[model samples]
Target: MIGTLRTVVLDAPDIKSLAAFYADVAGLDEHYADDEWITLNAADGTRLGFQRAPDHVPPRWPDPAFPQQLHLDLRVPDMAAAVEHAVKLGATRLPGGGETFTVLADPAGHPFCLCQSDGDSTTIADVAIDCASAGPLARFYSELLGLPVTWEGEGGAMISTEGRLPVIFQEIADHRAPRWPDPAHPQQLHLDVEVADVDAAEAAVLALGGVRLSGGGDNWRVYADPVGHPFCLVW
Candidate 1:
């Protein structure tokens, strides 16, 4: 039987940087940090993990030519402040004009969003991504999301933190990178992260094990890990 969503796994050049980024952004303390993986805790029992990838490539977004396969969405108090903060943190503004939402890139070049809402609560609801290696991916996410690796067997890997949200990384050996806007090769899923400060979040991400994939001006920035999975920081 399937359970609730727990943690999201991201591929990166450096797991430490990615974990640090999420840890600071989510306001979660670093539960574990090592060369192989890092994990952060969320209030809702959800966790985020960042795994090391030696050969990583940053993803391109909105271009349609390169296309971002997966990304995350973040909720913020003020859009303008969030955007400004992300830029200082090392995020690149994408071509999208800020309206109801703004698009930004993480250090890995993966796309994520910043949204404005009047809600008083600040919490993370989801974790999403796609990867070729499920075992490694699960382990990576477990550490990043502060989730424990559960159900480790030949079938695949299942992880959960706080015993509520259960994130599963199914084995997909023949996984192919999706091309953006192609429809034929559409992105399967993405992630949304809530952060206090955009710039500080980026810095923390870098400090942990993440790398800035692309950025310039005050628009947006893209970042990546050692493995190439992409995530974004917008300002």
Candidate 2:
């Protein structure tokens, strides 16, 4: 494994509001906060981060042009109560879902699923990503994070992490891979992967079909997986 999954960060125009929205709906607690970044701790110990992107462009899910690059799967005991709480917290219902799940967009306009849960409390079940082919991306993350491919099917795949929340990939025929730093094709979210040796991790990542991205610092370096999703190698 190249590194451990650190945190799943989302780009938001208003970090405060977006962070609060999740905290309320998913029972996350604010761990840290600032003007540009906010970190929240999920009940299951997953870290959810929000980064300020002043001119962030919200995704238009189900639309290829403004595709939803990523989303979160929230599991709650009471589907009806969860849906109501989400909508009341400025979330808007979106098209698509079944008996097991419902789709809705956050105030930032990122689509997420409210999945019915057998457990009592609400928690993030998965960090779902959109890609042209699920198999490749799933394999990439599986190797990088050392997470096993728990499931795979026609159009989707899932990688089980140490935490209860796993990372899921779904096939999007017309997926529009984001061009980072470009507001037009904004990268709505990214993963911060923790690594012990940045240089060694970089070598391994590149060898595993990863590409180096432009910006980074001493503690963190940016790279994109095989399918063009940005992720950071942080020590």
Candidate 3:
């Protein structure tokens, strides 16, 4: 891979509120803040960025029609306590159907889950994508981010490199791609990778089953992976 995965970004109608919600929930520090974007640096060696999307459409969890293209999983010491705290911080609990993990919608309506862990504090566990199949999408991201496929099975696959957050692909029977920049089908989440050169990285990405969708002149460009998930290449 020519670039390193930098951050997983979420589209939000109110950037500041979304950033604050995540920062507080994960106990992360505010690294950067502006009207358009806000970034949080987690103590567990992870970063999250939120961008303002005026016409953003919230996902309808458990409904394939309005799929949550991506979701965040976090490991917390106490699931019940975590849910309560999250609710206090502006998260709305969603019915989980008796699963061990608790699902909740953030202020901007993105669904995220809190899973019980044996730790004292919460930490990001994985950035998960809902895909029609796991292998190809996982492989595409594995190559793009230079992360190794740590686990694979019929249902899903996980890619991880030591000391970094994991990227997971879960096989969903009914998965739909985002129609980004459109309110009918919004991009719930996306990734950002930092590269040395935009042109070289763009070429590498195209060579590795990627397609360019947009560009920001010289500094950055956007592309969709084989599975139709949008990601960015930045210098």
Candidate 4:
């Protein structure tokens, strides 16, 4: 049987900047850093990785032309405070109503939501991504979301923060890149990272391994990893 979710990997043009943004927003510690990759650590030992890619472009959300196939939902104690913190860390706020949860974007422009939850920190809960090589994707995401890459395995990787939320990445032999604006070849998945300053966060992602796809001037921006996975950063 498949185990619990482990790591969440993100592709980007810059790895260092994205990793720094996530590290600042998620309140996690930086574990590893290099020219091509960065890793962070969660309280529970889960990890997040961000890898570099030169031709990365973020997606425009709510637009059918570049729809979001998959995204993340985060839980927090205070939505307003969380959003404020996220914005300060370089996240943008989407145009929408605030109800049960609030939506935000990462430096790479991947969409993610914030809510409130009460559960055991040690229990493996929430989203996971299975990829071909955990190293590249894990490093990419770790930098993008400020999450940490906790574990690395032959088949997959694990990323998390504060021992609460964890996003996992699994290895795939033949991973196919997603094509935006085309329903048939739409993006398969995406991620959302929190930050303090939207502009600073964007810059950080660019410095690491992510490329900005769209929405640079507005509150939200779209970005893509080196492998072409769409993500966002919202203030």
Candidate 5:
């Protein structure tokens, strides 16, 4: 395995405020925080981090110009009540979604889905990503993290990260790849992958079609997957 899914990071203008917003809405506990970054842990063993992005730009969903690189799919017990609570907690419901799921933009303007769930109180079900092709991206992550491609369909695919969290890649007809170092099209969401040997991991991922975006110093380096989603290799 190249690395493990350590944490999903979100770029936000105000790290503390956005971190608190998700913590309040989803009942996640703060794990670590500072002026630049904040990490939170959910009950279902999901971890998310908020990083300070001074000139952060929110994604314009349904628009190829500015795309949401990734989003979280939350499972709520009561759809209506959950929507009401989420709206109250600074989540704005976006227009155009089906009955089974309600699209809501978080305080930072990242579009996330509240799927109908009668199971848990409010759990992060999956991390869904928009991609041009589901199979290739799914395979990339699966092989990188050593996770299994548990589900596959015509237009969608899923990779299970053991019991920590699973990722869903939904096919988008007009998927737009983010151009890093350019604020015009930014990767609103990315991941921090923990690894044992940074050099070995980098070599493996590069061989797996991961593009090296920046130089590695000592602990970490940046890379974009084959589909242009940025993820870090942290040792």
Candidate 6:
């Protein structure tokens, strides 16, 4: 494995507002904060972060043109109450849902799913990524994070780690890969992985079908997984 998964970060024009929205709706606690970044700790040990992006462009899901590259699945015992609560927190309902899951857009315009869960309180169950093929991306992340593939079928797959939330892959018919650093194709979200040795992890990631995108600093470097989703390896 290249490294341990750190935080699932979302790009937002206003980091505080986006972080506040998730903190309230998902019941995550404040872990850290700064002008440009804010992170929250989920009940299951997962960390969610919001990064400041002044020129952020929100995705318009159900429309392939402005795709939702990745989204969180918040599970709650009461689906109706969860949906109502989310809507009250500046979330807008998006068409299409079933008894088990409902879709909504956060104030930042990022799409997320409110899933009917057995758990009593609201919690982040999974971080879902849109991909052209589920198997390959799932495999890439599985090796990178050292998470096992818990399920695979029906154009989707999931990798689960014991303490943190699982990451699921969904095959999108019209998936459009992002060309980040170019605002025309913004990366709405990304994963940050923590590694002991940045150089060694970089080698491991490249060997595992990841491409070096750019350098973050002495301790961190940006890379793109096999399917072009950007991620960072931090020491």
Among these predictions, the greatest lDDT belongs to 2
Compared with the true structure, model 3 gives a TM-score of 0.95
Where in model 1 is the C-alpha error above 4 Å? 125-235
Report model 1's TM-score to 2 decimal places.
0.53
Candidate 4, residues 39-81: lDDT per residue as tens digits? 7776766566676755666545555444443455555656677
Off by over 4 Å in 5: 215-218
lDDT assessment of candidate 6: 0.91
Candidate 1: tens digits of C-alpha lDDT, residues 1-235: 1112334556677677666665554456676778876767776566666756565656666554544555566666677887787777667888775677788887666667777757543445334344566677666555444577866777567676564555555444444554322334433333333344667766765665656754334534455533345445544
Q: What local lDDT does model 3 show for residue 86?
A: 96
Instruction: For each candidate in the order shown, give its overall lDDT on alpha carbons.
Output: 0.57, 0.91, 0.87, 0.62, 0.88, 0.91
* Candidate 2 TM-score versus the reference: 0.97
| Cα-based lDDT at residue 198, candidate 3 | 80
Better of 5 and 6 by lDDT: 6
Clash count for candidate 5 is: 0
The TM-score of candidate 4 is 0.52
Superposed Cα deviation of residue 220, candidate 6 (Å): 1.6
lDDT of 2 by residue, 1-235 (tens): 8898889999998999999999999999999999999999986689999999999989988788998898999899999899998999999999999999999999999999999999989988889889989988899999999999999999999999565468999998978898987899888999999999999999999999999999998799889888888999999
> What are the models' TM-scores?
0.53, 0.97, 0.95, 0.52, 0.95, 0.97
Q: Which parts of model 4 have CA positions greater than 4 angstroms off?
A: 2-5, 118-125, 128-235
Q: Per-residue CA lDDT of candidate 5, range 8-41, in tens?
A: 8999889998998889877899999989889999
Clashes of 2: 0
Tens digits of per-residue lDDT for model 3 on 1-235?
Answer: 7688899899988999899899889888999998998999988768899988888888878888888899999999988888899999999988772456989999998999999888898899999998999998888888888899999998999999888889999898878887655668777899989998888888888998988885464667888888788888988
Q: How accurate is candidate 5 locally (lDDT)?
A: 0.88
